[model samples]
Target: LRETRSYTWGLVIPDLTNFGFASIARSLEAHCREAGIQLLIACSEDDPALEQRVVDNLISRQVDGLIVASSGHSDDIYARIHDRLPVVQLDRHIGESRLPMVISDACKATAELVRDMASECGAEIYYFGGLLDLSPSRHRLAGYELGLHRAGLEADPARVRHRDYQPSSGYQLMAELVAELGAPPRGLFTASFTLLEGV
Candidate 1:
C-alpha cells in the first residue's frame, strides 16, 4: 500500500475570508491529518494572477495532487499541472478543462427556492447575483430565470442585478432597486450568503 505520510496535496482557494471556503479548508485540514497526509494551502484573494502564482509555487513543491477553487479562467495552468499530477477542481472551475470537479448544484436548488418564493408571494421576483463572469453567478442567474419561467412569471431585466459577491455590492444594488421601485420585490433571491447579509 502507498504510504499516506509520503503524500502531500495542494489546495488553492479564492479567498479564505469567505466563511464557506474557510469551512471547507478547515474540514480538509482535519481529514488530511486523520489520513496522515500533508496539506499545503494557498489563498488567491480572488485574483487570477495570484492564483496562477500560488499554483506554480505548489507545482514547484512537487505536491502529489492539486485542488483548486479557481478565481478565473486558468485552463492552461491547470492543463500543465494535470500533465504532471492529478488535479481536482472545487467550487468554481476554469472553462472547459475537463478536470474532476466537486461543485454545488446551486443552479437547480436556487431555481427551486425562487420558484417556491414566487408561488407564495404572488408578486414579481428579483434576483441579486454575483459577478456575471463567474460560472456560479451565471448558473444562479440562469436558474433564477428558469425558476421564473416555471412559475409563469416573466424575468424582468430591470429587476435583476449582478454585482461582486460582497456585502457592499449587495447593499448598493438593493438600495438602487428600492430607489427605483419605491419598495422591495415581494420575492427576492440572493446568490450568496454574504450578499444576503447585505440585503
Candidate 2:
C-alpha cells in the first residue's frame, strides 16, 4: 500500500567544520552505511535560511529521517518537518517541542568543573561563553554560577561574557578582559570548544 523506503537519512548541522559535529556525522555515516542506509549530510553554516533550503532539499529527496543541529532561529521548520518525518534535534534545539532531542548535559558537568576551578584557584574566576539563544550555552552559564555557589564564591557579573560561538568572539572577549584588568585572568573557564579554541 505504500512506497518503498528510501533507506536514506539526512543530517543538518550548524557547522560541519566543528570537530564535535564532524565526529557525529562521521559516526552516523558509518552506522548508516553498515545498515545499508545512505547518509546525506548538509551544513547550515549557522544560517536559518540555508538550513531551511537544505531541509527542504532533503525532504524532496524523501529521506527516511533527519538529525538537525539547528541555528536556534525558529521552530517552525523542524516542527513542520516532524509532522511527516522523524526529526531528531541533536546538539542544539530551539525549545522544548514535541520532537525528541539528543543533547549533552552541560549544566551539571559545567557546575562541577567550575567548582573545581574555584577551589583550586581560590580567586575570582571568569566565564567565557557563547550565545544564550541555544540551550547548551544557557545550561553552561547556569552551571558556572552553580559551581561558584558550591565553591562558596559568587559569580562576578562583570567577568562573564556571552558572545556568539565563534573563535573571533572568543578572542575579542579575551582581549576585552585583559584590557580591562591589564592582565590575563587567573581562573578562566571557557565554554564551547570553539570559544576555547578562540581564546
Best by TM-score: 2
After superposition, candidate 2 runs with Cα above 4 Å error: 1-3
lDDT of 2 by residue, 1-199 (tens): 1775899999999787677888999999999999999999999887788988999999999999999988865777778888888999898867766678898888899999999998777657899987787788889999999999999988879878888878888899999999999998888888877887888
- Expressed as tens digits, the lDDT of each residue in 31-148 for candidate 1 is 9989877889999877888888998898788788999988776578787778878899998867887989999997899878888888887547888888787788888998988888
In terms of TM-score, how similar is model 2 to the real structure? 0.93
lDDT of each: 0.84, 0.87
Report the error of model 2 at residue 117, Å: 0.8
